[model samples]
Target: MANLFQKIRKGLQLYQQIDMEALEKLAAKVDLNAVVQNVSKLDDTQLQGVMKLLSGSGGHKKKVPPPVDGDFYDLAELLTPEQRALQLKVRAFLETEVQPIVNEYWLRAEFPYELIPKLAALNICGVTYQGYGCPGLPNIMEGVLAMEMARIDASIATFFGVQSGLAMGSIYMLGSEEQKQQWLPAMQQMTCIGAFGLTEPEVGSGAAGGLTTTAKRTPEGWVLNGQKKWIGNATFADVIIIWARDVDDNNVKGFLVKKDNPGFQAIKMEDKMALRIVQNGLITLTNCQVAETDRLAKANSFKDTAEVLRMTRAGVAWEAVGCARGAYENALAYTTQRKQFGKPIAAFQLIQNHLVEMLSNLTAMQTMVFRLSQLQDEGRLTDEHASLAKVFCTLRTRDIVSRAREVMGGNGILLQYNVARFVADAEAIYSYEGTKEINSLIVGRAITGFSAFV
Candidate 1:
């Protein structure tokens, strides 16, 4: 026992003589992997003591990256303080009022009739117009509003687009002074709803060249005949801007047909795969009589109708950004909580790759649309500019939403996850506002001076 005590005393003295500073310098030169392996074998108590000692040491610790926002470029910062605040108000409304009811109404393929007044309270309809109860805001604000609405529910966004962009834009841009004074004020206040009737069962992308719906001048007024399909808000709108070929001039003209017209019938289309909350209709107009006073005075041909389309197509691109942003945000939140193998799946490399790719694409879309809106505000926007944005944004949206669904597995397919609806909605956005192929062709024709559609 005495010999053992002497040996322990010698070991303690030797330990006190060793300098940790000198050893640390030497440790850099040596393969400390052996030391790490030995230290890893230590029991919990020893490791805890070691960690306590090392906690105050000088090595810098690695930091985990922050969670990414779908607006990776922070484009909202470009807005004025007032506009940004308004943007938040709209976002809050969507998150609170719209988000809760969207999945329910979507499941039933019904519109929330109660929301019309609540939405009107925002006073954003006719957002870009100058007078007649409109907000007279900039084009960027209009695009931002569309994005906010779509982030929660694309159907509500579509409903608003038809009312604000397609219907009201046509009147604002092409209606007679009397026509504007008559419908613009009430419609801007949301007391009157409006829809656009341009697409037909036979003509979708060729709306400019091949409208089968016909209108004839009879001294009493004009008679409109033919069928209109996929008309948003048609079943309930107070006024519908129907574009039809004039039998005399062989030119397309616009007429504001009232809902109660005996010859005009709007039947709600059912069993739709997407945007179910939007009340799309198939309208059969058999000698639908529109008074001469209701005809848009400035609309002479399809070229006039294309003016309205040019303005609204850019808004659709912004809507695609919102859809992609919604899906990305939901999937990101899900990944942070969803665990696999006793760790967050987000910690895995592959999951992070998917997330990064989504954010990159989303940021690109947002920035592109931001510039697109800027060009519109500058009056530099053209058909090719808007079409290019629509084509790229909607196509990328499909990819983003699909990845969002993949990340959530089965929950991604369910509407409650917030991603499934976007997935379906993306499909519709892709085809609408001109399909990707058609829009691509439009851009192709612009840049190359070649018409590929033939």
Candidate 2:
């Protein structure tokens, strides 16, 4: 009983360290006699810990969270300082200029013409081309820039790919020096917009063997007839690179069909569920006359058209990465701040699992496309190489966006959330350029050395 009395005196002495007013408030809420009894039961080590905690010397410190970055492997460190700067510049432009109005324009299914001049000012168009006012940067820069653009808006990225990769690449690879001199500079400056016309209502994947659009040679030049569907930028493009079968030779040839041609007609495709900001057009040509001077000078067969597709397919893969990254980042930010059960949803085990899976896929895609661009820059890129990346990245992108939407619940479907846009646009990316089955077959053929593309 004497020892217990001494312990209680020590506990009372510790309580005296606190202000009188604080002790009074604590006494109101807690039974001081009970607390003193409990304190008296503690040994020396336990008493020291309690003293440290009460004095704010050993209490939990506010945690400093790491920044939310999706590049888990830091793949961007591979870029040159200049390239990194350019990438950040493009990202800033998209976030500041495009992000604010994209949902509005996307909702309206209308192109934002105001951004064209702003984009042109970046001087990134025809990024991989060497001459005629082109930037002549490494092909990896092209992939990186495509990612940055699509990270904010896939429609804008599609429009750019059509201009830089498909339209300019056709002329640069197949056109004569004179032809390149005439169009590339103007197109590079974005003063002259261009579109690519290859997919028809009846032909998409079968374009290698079957193009119904026919071009007949005449004294007046060439007369083009047939419909080209899903032509991006066609509604307002100054020039459309129309791939048509030569009537006499029965070979696929490319024509620079000017929008002003008598028979050239482009009608805006309405009510699209994806890529609505892109002014996709259904082009009708009733004897559309393209001058001989305007023909892609050296393009004589579908093999030539395949070259353009191979290059652009790699860009599509990067665009898919961008889409996935956007959705993952958005979902991650949402989870960290969005609370449930009196804590952040991100604190939950299942939410962290979803985020980890997304990061894994996104990291895989980023590294794959990085190497794919290296192959392109080295001149070793093949149809199979590009096809594989397109297949894997887009397929993974669909999964990531779906998971992103699922985590967000009903807000996932709302346009204000932004993941809804990625979910819809991913469907378009997966199907366009090449379907999942088509790209997979391309890879399968290369690996097994068997032509499975029947």
Candidate 3:
């Protein structure tokens, strides 16, 4: 009996590597002892029969399972048919084109310039605006578009947000008729990309009061002299809307500074751990001269800048929802396939609790943004309303993405899973439009009738 066992073990070892644990499981399903005894003394034909009994394949290859997805909550159904169609269109574009190449570009900290013309074909730029060859979609549609772009790649969404929401919005809301006519069409097509330079080197959350970028009237035009930091798309934009304090009136003014102006220079900000695909620029305006015609006529003070932010802040809240959704979906799918203790980890009660919590937060954010958009369409929205949504959604997104990383265990940090990118991007969203402290104060001031922001 011992000799028979030794012979059988040698034969199995010669054929292929055997995992003892897996072989033990297989051993339970068949009389391996008897089969080994029979095969040890058998000729080639008998051994072949014994092997055939163990092999499950009957002239068919094992089929691979289809990909698992994280959208288990069916949130996409909340979108209207038209909105859903647009969402899918952008999703397809991003999954096919952006997803495949995004990690490589992000690793190098470079923008995918080739996508500009491809994205221009989508005609989604300036989606919420009128004329200028834009689509004139509704405010809800704008939020959907932002969410769609962010679902695949937040850096691309940020680039789009700055161009369509902040830069073009400044012109649409505050520029002279001639200024709008000259810039909007070209910008809509991306023939001339635009950048919004509002945050200075020293002023971020307190930009409205602490901005040191100054503009002085000169015989030639306006001479802009200051430094702007964290200016997205500034490196390559054809025109940049620079917010500067007018020396005469101490009021913030917007100037459309052309890229080629001799005194204006933009250096790419490098070594960023978040949003690596975004090309943030550190801009220096040393007496950068601009034509008076380039001045935004209606943007008289910092109040005008706040108007642009209020419009985009709601979209940022929707973007937070997208980021959370992306992270939750990726983490949920991971737990399903990753096995532990002889079953999917997703089956564990703790994992289900985390997933349910993420979904609840996600649902709340979605519903809030939907109402916020309705208010915007009705022209009944207030700054506090938008601020509240932004604060809640972004705060919840930070929690969702962090939990997503935790649920994936070791693999969560990998870039290919897609959640890691969202995790990093969420940090930017948390503080960008306004910090939580600043946004909370906006809401507090409205509710308590006392300003809390110092």
Candidate 4:
């Protein structure tokens, strides 16, 4: 009788283990007593296997996928702890402060003026320059920061590039000691914004010798007369680094053209499809007189101007990487979450292929820019090196952004999805700094020892 009681208790425990709903369906098909008799005849191993099948413990748990990240090779691991921290800090600031409002500003074709003080507080304006309130970090940091900013919004990246690289760089590389002391600190603090006036209305690719803006030396000062087109940040910049041809020597020189100059007028260029948030201006410098002392002290020729372009072009390559990264990441996330036929589109073979292609290009661009920055830091960077990176990265960025847009179908074109902005912005990046053909000729000239420019 005791043994019978123990068996009853064991049977009750096993009954509790069975799913009542599944048991009810089975009971409707088969006799409950017969099913129990068969289950009771099983050996311990067979009984445990039956229990395993019934419990739905197919031996292991489903594996969770790692988080989506564009840095496939873990490039961030290359930075020092402090450098990595700074990179994250800047990234956090951009994601929090800039990402939320970027689409609105880009749609309105306006700059967010309020971000200036906040961006300044980060103290990252003059990223690579030493002294004068600059961070004096390595060139890689500048490139990384550029990537981080562009990752969120290319317009903001371009704005910072104009202020830090083009304008401040012109002064730092060619300005007099007094000029650096006067402008560097203020610009670094974001109190005085700056603009770079290089590409004129008619002379972009041929700016080397075709600058129509003429500056004549006068007893009172220098008179700058001509027009500059596509001048970023020109609408409200405190100072404009106007590169003009010397009327007498026919050599290009740079000057500190103040915004308040009566002869200087900047009207915002309207209806830009790409990089609309950047306040590009049609600057008319009628008799824009700049003090002789305000002239870039060391800008003797166009070669000096090329120097600044060479340095900033590397940053542009990194910007391309950032743009590609943003698009690719957004697309990847979208594909995984957007369902079709009861499964993620990302699981589809064609979608996976597209993703692999994007990752392949993105990884290549990132590695290329990483080496490019290393060359800059080592002081071995040349125009060809920068142009090659700019060409390859921008071209691949165009491809990446295109593929990114393609994967999302109709939703890709929507600004709210974010891929559309990159698609438009990639066109601007591809053309600016230097066109693909121009950069190719630069590399062509370096490789073949011949001039391809007409």
Candidate 5:
């Protein structure tokens, strides 16, 4: 009885030292009775945490955005019924299969190998090539497919581009009948993955004028010695299309570099900020001997290489639009649902202005890429045309993603929100496949009737 009385006296003394006024103010801000009922169920540590949150001193996380429709321009109407069906099919597969695992794989900076066969099952590779188990569809369909892939994940779109556009396009355009017959069918089926080794450690926008990677003709075949950087899928691809400078003719040539060659090595690049899921490689070829039969028959000059770039640039433009569209849709969904001061922040005039600007840019980019693909279908596409689209679409994509990040506030930086990935990837798209400055120069030269590449 004496111990119980002493404990009660100590509790009374501690209660007298509490700040009742501050506690009352905090209690007035929320339902004090409900808070009491909830915290009553908590242990001592949890009750302390609850008090910290009530005082606004604890870590607060922003809410994530919900799933949203990205296509604001309704460009699907332009595609034929079959085309639209295929588009929807690809979109559904991406949303169902890829979306669930993308953030996880991207955070780990690793490729999702299990998805390759599933992508191949779609029968979309080599969409424009004839024969060889290819679809032989129009180029517009190719661009549309790229958009669909990128709308969900840019890294997957890049992997597909390396296979279907760069590697297969090289063989389809420049390889001999025997070479095409040997590789095209398996590649078209995605049974054999391929990569393109064109851009070297030191050569990029000025690749036409200079390439240090050399190929020498010998009795055994051609000996290739050079290094390639940023070769997508190189770490696992069965075959790599290597571009090298022929020492004898002083011309650029393409070679089929087998991944199993004793002299060929590909090291996976690590710690990339953008496109983390893409397995880019730094390849070194030392005395790599190849049979003459494996050399691209028609690729005797750099102009042949430019042809592949011109064809692929349109797809890159479409990818930019898709990335931008994705970010915009996510931002829109977040702003509509997220509240501020008892109202949705999107109701404000300033927020509406940002949203309107993003939509306007997105619509313009879609229409431009749509027409660009139509021109490609008509066989009227020039480097300047594709370059112009590349510059415009990628530039506008930066704007759209920026506004998207702005509207989402702090949640914009979190990968769970999706817009952060788009923002990081837009930087890569802006520079690869020709930088904005290089592409703009191509357009500037065409308009002024004078070359300004220097």
Candidate 6:
């Protein structure tokens, strides 16, 4: 009995230690269950076969052809050299810099403020916007950059999206020249951080028509009174763009609320299961006053708010792609390394199916977002277009991450395997920026000429 136990343990260890190519060949020859069942009865020949499988005999030598990358159809080749270089540069940064410490920070639910200066050096903030020290690249560049960032860490990407896309976008789209001149350059350089507060505690989906936060006109300026929830970066942003309904006209207005305003207090929201690295805040505006000059000049109505949502929604889709891609890549690498029955699990047909399915979904999402950004760059994107991509990509991201975790088995649940973090963060993506149900209804409204978001 002791000898048999030793043999089984040795077989398991050998299987766990072998290279992918040898494991693949071994997986084809034996049923792992049968080996376990016959563990005690196995003779010398069987034990030698098991060891051969683990040792990469039977013509197993190469790295199993690089494990079928998730970018199956070479969609990245569509990118120009400059865009491709940027994507690779960001990917290298995430893998080398962020990947090592993100899990620890996430477990502690703390933001890595130290990474800000390093992130600023990437020079990607306000990427698609022109002027004021912004990159002013095409919209496709923005989507690609978001994808690269999310591919490494979704929380980091969300933090950047709030700062660059939501906050900077408000200023670029609605601020007067002086306002943009005053804020954009510093925000772009990461010298001053920013946040956008649009979702109120009582008015999330209904924010378009019904904002509970009210801005009453005062002789001094505007006295704002309302509560904003899930306001990313509000806790530490130097400036926050608060959206409130005007009490007099009932129209939504945006104000630049500085962090130190006496009436403006932002409390950090805690105990989040996902995107823990993003500093979500519950902002209370009790007579928070803003000068008339601080109000956005062009944002006279909710249509301007919708415009900002439309622009950022596409970036959200790219973030979903990144999250899915991250999970898929990690799962693929893990499966190739973890072994059972004297062979790597990835060599099994069923495991390969899971991997292939994940890749297919990830590839489809990448292609869809790439085209979505192209439409955005050409000035032809619509709300429905962005909504459709958001719906498809986020929905698919959930499936991809689940399969990724499944393929990892027990380790999938552990935060260190990488897929686990993606799985948790994918849930947040599923809920935010319009829930799957809401985004689908938005698309349904466009396609069927029917409103379904009751």
Top-scoring candidate (TM-score): 2
Using lDDT as the measure, the top candidate is 4
The TM-score that candidate 4 achieves is 0.90
Q: Would you give me the overall lDDT of model 2? A: 0.93
Report the Cα RMSD per candidate: 7.9, 3.2, 7.7, 3.8, 11.3, 9.4
Better structure of 2 and 5 per lDDT:
2
> Candidate 1 residues 297-376, lDDT tens each?
99999999988998999999999999999999989989988889977778889889999999999999999999999999
Which residue pairs collide in model 4, if any? none
Runs in model 3 deviating more than 4 A are: 1-79
State every prediction's TM-score relative to the real structure.
0.88, 0.92, 0.85, 0.90, 0.85, 0.87
lDDT scores in order: 0.91, 0.93, 0.87, 0.93, 0.90, 0.90
Candidate 3 lDDT over 230-335, as tens digits, reads: 9999999999999999999999999999999879999999988888899999999998889899899999899999999999999999888878878887787788
Q: Output the better candidate (2/3) by lDDT.
A: 2
Q: Name the regions of candidate 2 deviating beyond 4 angstroms.
A: 1-29, 43-62
lDDT of 5 at 170: 95
**Candidate 2 vs. true structure, TM-score:** 0.92
Poorest lDDT segment (10 consecutive residues) of candidate 5 = 1-10
| Runs off by more than 4 Å, candidate 6 | 1-68
Which scores higher on TM-score, 1 or 4? Answer: 4
